[model samples]
Target chain A: MALEKQSRAAFWVTVLPPTLWIAVFFLIPLGIVWAYSFGHNEGLTGVAITGTFDNYIRAFDPLYLQIFGKSIAVAGLTTLLCLIIGFPVALAIVFANEKMRPLLLLLVMLPFWTNLLIRTYALIAVLRTEGFANWTLAWFWNQGSTLAALVGLQPFPAYQPLELLYNNFAVVVGLVYVHLPFMVLPLYAALDRLDKSLMEASLDLGAGHLRTLFSIVVPLALPGIVSGVIITFVPALGAYLTPDLLGGTDSQMIANVIERQFKRANDWPFGAALSFLLMYATFAAIALRAYLTRGQPADGHGI
Target chain B: MDQLAQRTQDAAAHKPIISFRNIVKRFGSMTAVDNVSLDIMPGEFFALLGPSGCGKTTLLRMLAGFEVPTEGSVLIDGQDMGETPPNKRPVNMVFQSYAVFPHMNVADNVAYGLKIDGLPKDEIKARVQEALDLVQLGPLAARKPDQLSGGQRQRVALARALIKRPKVLLLDEPLSALDAKLREAMRFELSQLQQKVGITFIMVTHDQDEALAIASRIAVMHKGAIAQLGTPSDLYEFPASRFVADFIGSVNMFEGTLIKDGADEAVIACPDLAPYSVHLPHSAPGSAGASVWVAIRPEKLNLHKNASEPPAVPDCPPAHNVARGEIKEISYLGDSSIFHVQLSSGQLLRVSRPNRSRYEQEHFGWGDTVWVSWAGSSPVVLLS
Candidate 1:
């Protein structure tokens, strides 16, 4: 690209800082990790450069592969749920009048103002056993039991607090809650730019509202849907905090296993290999999104 | 039979296909349409002509069931459409943007309405082709909307709406997006297409020329109410109000007072006509000594070389309804010439003459003394 602005020298002046920063802080560390993936771990915090495939072969063990499969399924489910819930929210925002539109959009993005760690903690308060979910249910059950006793009927059984936290369900819920904005922003961008007359034309042609939503609105929003699915799925696949904080022992994902390899297991080479695999999978998701949107320009999904 | 006779025959023969009764639409404090009562006959190409913000499109949308009127009921074939949605209503619209689905090809777009109704596959296929062929777009069915030209896209929209066999077809500013040359071509195409389909076509357009060229009857709307509704010739030659008269075409107006109101004729006395009084056919809706304005089209006024030479009327003097003026400016359009003459009373009047042959007529130049004249029936006096 030609930098034909106020000055040719301004190109280097503005670009050099970010390039140097990425090179020094990001790409260089990533390159070191990549180099360590092939090395053999020597004794006492030293890794010798041996260039062996032992770490990669070990990564395909049934245990690691099972974790990988479970991670994929969880990420897929999370992305699907986000899309199912986000599409309507995006549509609502797009159809809202001018005065209410920006305010509704702000509500969708308000969660990001607080840190993700705090928001995940807040969710834990809502979903945990003896938390708000169980407390509310217990209150309803008590009221029903009291009404039954007063009406000359057998009293209901004792109330039991349901287990909602520390399970696969909580992990999925947490991931969906975190990544919903990723799905909604792109959809809102696409749906807002749509020409409303197309919907009117479809209705005027004798198609009802549901038929027009499928035939006209959904197909036109395909690119944004694909973008949202890819971004949300990739991030949820590599999520560490959500699964670690909310998942049960049987629901450990590939990310938690990679973290164990780095910390408790103290296997640096294996951890590096596992993290690289996760990075490659992320790359694959982005590449698929690019292939889907080949002829169209990659639009900015600003929240 | 003549056009007006056929229209009268149609009215006497059948009930109106679509009727709008006392339609009033308001958004908050702003009234968009105020008590509009109109009936569209079967197979008539009726047009709503107005300037922008005059609520023409809003009226069309109400008929198509897109906008619900605040105080009216729309009817189709004597059936009251009180709560009918657009999909249930037997009307389709061709949008101003020509909202052909970008994701679908021309064939799919044309087949959309039939497919939604769940017709048989073979029948849908056959009908889609026929509709495309009607718009002369048979070969381009496989192309998407983006691949088509503006006129071709518009034709695709037409075919898509027509395949439904709706009782009434609505068009909103159909040709306003095309270039001038393409618009002229499509004007004939749309009128011919309407005749072929034999469906009642209600079109909303701000262009007076387009409405006059195609519509059997035109409603001129102003400020949320119709100013006049009449046949094209009636609207052109004898507009009911000064707004209608000034809007349709260019005309010269002179303030006058009605000197005499005879049975079929009235004499107008004006300061602009220092030596002559106007002998109009008494069209100003007022009595004697009432202030009025005399309107004459530029082409209706005649020019003569000398002040004493009378115009086309027999046995009439030149100065009777004629005034002497000097040619202030001359504008030469390709086929005709417009002369801006300054009368002896210092009132400016435009006189247009057709250039019948090459270099043969009495051409008036700047600062030339000329006498401008018009027959008694040429001018329509207005109250405004």
Candidate 2:
């Protein structure tokens, strides 16, 4: 009896740290968010802790709804663009000849070795008005004017250089570039596992190349594609860095709004409520993805 | 069943389906398939038998259109297959690994080719059902590949390839994945299935027993070349070279230099055995000075009491081919007995005899003195 008691005590002792850590760090914070979602914020000074539905009601207002919709659209576009550009690159790396594959894979992962913010900043130097592209365009325009005077008609109209900095397009490009390797790595892993004979079998059965890709390759690779999308989409939905640096005032996302409420706006209760809403939205998207692919193997959980 | 059998009989009367002309395939620095030529008659069961890396699978793949020949042309029904892709070719293959789609159920797997060819829905369903029934997998049509046994999956692969009703069906080691007992049973079933379907079935396998059992003609390949191509009995009874004789089955070989050649007989003085004369189909007088290996199957030799006493025998044996040896060991398997004997010149010869009821009464144990001898026509002369 004494030995049994000592063994039971040892089991709990071993399990206590991780159990307490999860309860303290995850469950407690979630409970606090749940509590704050029901509470009302007082003006400026503090929040008067009381149960209310006003915060959720305000969250669904046109202003906030528009931001939420825009966030979804932007994140969806980013994910689609990443998939389009990443899949073929991943395929090339995976199917390259033995000696070249390691070098190609290294090139794909090289961008991730540096700080992500530094990489995004590097793009600013290339796309800005005073950058290399604009300088080349200016040089071409001057040459065209001189040639027009010599033999051609009037020179083309003087063009103001492209204004790409601090725009939603830049934000989208940045999101795709930053999140591309995440998408490609998973896709490479999945495509590498696919049987080469299956492709041969499809070709042997009278399906042409395009037909085989759509019918056999695409459907079989749906798991990997979905994983890549989730990996890019979920983080992109709550992204703040790219938008803060590249987007205009009108292009601010829900995550930027939440950040503003916590640090700049100083609305702790409202920020907590917004954070809970973001968490719920992410969870809902995951649940819906699971529900759609219910019976597929390895489909339920999002990466 | 009767209707299916009748259809198979009707299909068997068809003419030559596929032919090959000097096909060659190379991979970078290695020649996977050397220049090869063959013709596959309609509804014939043909086999390509060889060890691993012997280009048998490459040849099979070339016929399936998964691989294109580096040199010569392949024709299906006299149609040039050079420009034809695998799907357009009237051929289908059962892959070596049984490449059944894991996500698909048995019916869908069998129906894949029909659907890909844009068959009508009703026709696809009917054909899939027919194929499932043909392979005796009708009851498991709804189960996925992982849910079935290895043999069942192999049947599904076979059914999938056969349902296309192509002019030719290629199978690459279809029975290699099964256990010994199941492989034996499936070999008989596959042979019967081919006869029933009456498609030109070409299979590649390393197992000699499988080739001998199912093939109407077997092509033994070695080092990217066809060593011998003939009926199984022709190969077993009269192998053309030392490689074929040594590879096909268990045979006792004696190395010797040919000494004398006549119109019907040639004498070889073995360096390690008694000089013996062997009957030849034709005069090989110039081949006397060349080194040769004489081969005799273990079952052909008979055991006698004394070496010198057998100057004549009542069995109407051929003249001049006889050897005497002492039995060194006896191996008693249930249905037969194998005797390992040592000749006076220290060459060992193995002799196998059926364990008949009368023979069982006279058992030869280890360390027995016995004469091993065979008629002149029994041993095959191999020059390589």
Candidate 3:
């Protein structure tokens, strides 16, 4: 009985540190947010717990609703783009020869060595007007005209730069660029563990490359896909930095609105409420992902 | 009369279902399969038997269109398969892992190939039902592959491959994943299923017993080349080389030299035991004075306490074919007991005796002096 008691004490000793850390850092801060969401605000600075639903009601306002919808759209589009671009990169790394695989994975993760803010700024240099994109376009346009004169056709007109930066498109581009490795690493891990024999069996069973890719590879890699979407989508939903630097007035997401509430408008309760709203949505996505991938085996377990 | 004549002529002109012509596969500096040629007959259950890295699986994969030969060609039904993709080939394979699709249930897995062929919905449903019933998995068609046991998953793989009814079916170590009892059961099931379906099956396996039990003909491969190919009994009893003789089953080998190479019999002189005489299997491949190894099966050698036992050869002395040994160990298998006897020449010879009687006439225990002997036809001469 004394030994059993000692083992129980040992178990709690091992578990105490991380539990205390989470309780202090995460649960306590969240409780503060939840309590503040129900409180009434004093003039400019003070807060008191009157327990009203007024802040939540204001969260459903048409202006805020529009911001939420736009945030969802931007996050959804960014996730879709990441999946589209990152899946092929992951597959290439998985299927590459042994000597080249490490180099390719290193390149995928190399972006993380630098600060994301610096990377977003670097994208600005390439995406702004009269930047590298338009210069390349102008060079191609000049070449088209030169070739047109050489062929004795009509001469083409000069090029003008496309409006490429400071919009929703720029925000999505920045988000996708920043979070692509997040999408790829999980997918690469899942695909690397997949049995190559299953792919061969698919082909031997008369599935073409495209059909096999859709039916076998994607479904077998569903857990990774779910986690990749979660990793990319949740952050993209609550994104503040990319939209702040790359977005204009029309392209502001909910994070920008929440930022205005706290730092600019000095409405801390409303900002906390909006922050909880985003957290609730992310929680729902995580729960749905858990429910969907509950029984999925990480390694390919079947034919 | 006309129908019979035409049928006989057609049988005479029947071509092989698959053929490998001077095939060679090389990976960088290493040759995986070297100058291999073979023809698989229609409806014949063939096996490629070898140790790991002997290129048996490489040969099987080349036939499945997973690997193309570096030199020469592969022909299926007399058509060149060099440029054909795996999905376009008229062959299906059951992988060693049984490669069941994890996402789909059993019925969907069985119906996959037919669905890809754009078959009508009812036909596919009926075929899937039939295939599942064939594997006796009709009741569990809705269960996922992970939910099934190892044996059930293997049956699902079989059902899926057989549903397509391809010209050839390739199995790569299909029974290696099952437990011992399940492997034996599946071996019987595989042989019976092959006979029932009448589709050509070419299996690659390292288990010699499995190949012997299921295959109509076996090809024993060594280092990317076929060392011997024959029926199981021929390979077991009249093995052409030392490798085949030792690989197929346990044998007592005596290093010897051919003393007399005659048309009717060949005599081998060994320092251990007695001079061995083997009834030559027509046209044995060696000359007089050539070094050879004499291999004799354990069951062929009879153990006795004395040389005065009756019904023995009266023309030759018993010492010419007998050796004196002391029993060192006894292994009591249920059906038979094997005795490891140490000869006076320091050779350990294994002798298997059946436990035919509940009360034996005599019991031979360890440290008993015994005489081990065989007839002239029992030993096979291996030249390699």
Best by DockQ: 3
User: What is the per-residue lDDT of model 2 for residues A20-40, given as tens digits with 9 covering 90 to 100?
Assistant: 999999999888877877776
* Model 3 residue B150 lDDT score: 94
Q: For model 3, which pairs clash?
A: A303-B99, A303-B100, A303-B101
- B166-189 per-residue lDDT for model 3 (tens digits): 999999999999999999999999
- Residue A299's C-alpha lDDT in candidate 3? 53
Tell me which of candidates 1 and 2 scores higher on DockQ: 1
| DockQ of predicted model 2 | 0.39
Off by over 4 Å in 1: A1-6, A297-303, B1-9, B270-277, B281-283, B305-320, B323-330, B340-348, B366-370
Q: State the lDDT of candidate 2 residue by residue for B8-49, as single tens digits.
A: 575466545777788888999899888888777887899999
| lDDT of each candidate versus the true structure | 0.89, 0.83, 0.88
Tell me the tens digit of each residue's lDDT in model 1 across A79-139: 9999999999999999998999999989999998989899989989999887898899999
RMSD per candidate (Å) reads 3.1, 5.6, 3.8
lDDT of 3 by residue, A1-303 (tens): 999999999999999999999999999988998888888779768988678888889999999999999999999999999999999999999999999999999999999999989998998888899888888998999999999999999889778888889998899999999999999999998899888888888899999999999999998888889889999999999999999999987999999999998888887788888999999999999999888788655453443
lDDT of 1: 0.89
C-alpha lDDT of residue A52 in model 1: 88
